[model samples]
Target: MPGQLTLQGKVSAGVESGCLVMESGGKQYLLVGGDPAVVKPGAEVEVRGVLKPDLASFCQQGEPLEVSSAKGR
Candidate 1:
């Protein structure tokens, strides 16, 4: 898992439609390419995925995380 990252956080609704915010490591990360319904607002979760630092995103959702897997923690 060269670029894989495991982060513990909570999901929040993004400013834009269909986008999600992951509050982790004292920062907010944007979640892309997954079923947003899998996570709920303010619910604690752990996400395993690759970081797409160079990916473009809307709002101030920090970096983009192309999540590979996620679950309630």
Candidate 2:
């Protein structure tokens, strides 16, 4: 049920390839293999993915919405 929710946040850190750090609602989350367009630090994003059981991983297999452009929506 957690993955069914859409989370809005800003990219805080673009770490190594396929790994990114984001801050959502005051909480920090690590998203892997995320779209680079939305992984840029300070970039706003709408993530639609499932949170792993570890609670440290956010898997984004679907498309992500980058705040850089309103067209992505």
Candidate 3:
């Protein structure tokens, strides 16, 4: 994890099939390891995680976010 980011933005529909997405600093991050049901669309949130490039998934949405923790603000 070379590029870790502490991002805060509104949760939105992920480009992937069923993933939570956050847009911050003009970048889109696909959040993994979180309950999709718990995160609402357009809800403001802060996510602490790292950008993982090698991680592959069904949801090839944007940058894969290896989320350590995420919470609504």
Best candidate (score: TM-score): 1
Clashing pairs in 3: none
Going through the candidates in the order shown, the clash numbers are: 0, 0, 0
Question: Tens digits of per-residue lDDT for model 1 on 1-73?
Answer: 8989889888888888767888777877888755455666777888888899988776666689888887887
Runs of candidate 3 with Cα error greater than 4 angstroms are 1-3, 35-38
Which sections of candidate 2 miss by over 4 Å? 14-18, 55-73
- Candidate 2: residue 50 Cα off by (Å): 0.3
| Structural similarity to truth (TM-score) of each candidate | 0.82, 0.54, 0.77
Can you write out model 2's per-residue Cα lDDT over 1-73, one digit (the tens) per residue?
Answer: 4345456776655444454666667666665445565456677777766555354333333223222221112
Give the candidates in order of lDDT, highest first: 1, 3, 2
Candidate 2 lands at a TM-score of 0.54
RMSD of 1: 1.7
- In terms of lDDT, the poorest run of 10 residues in model 3 is 31-40
Q: Flag the better candidate by lDDT, 2 or 3.
A: 3
Better of 2 and 3 by TM-score: 3
Checking candidate 1 for backbone clashes, the offending pairs are none
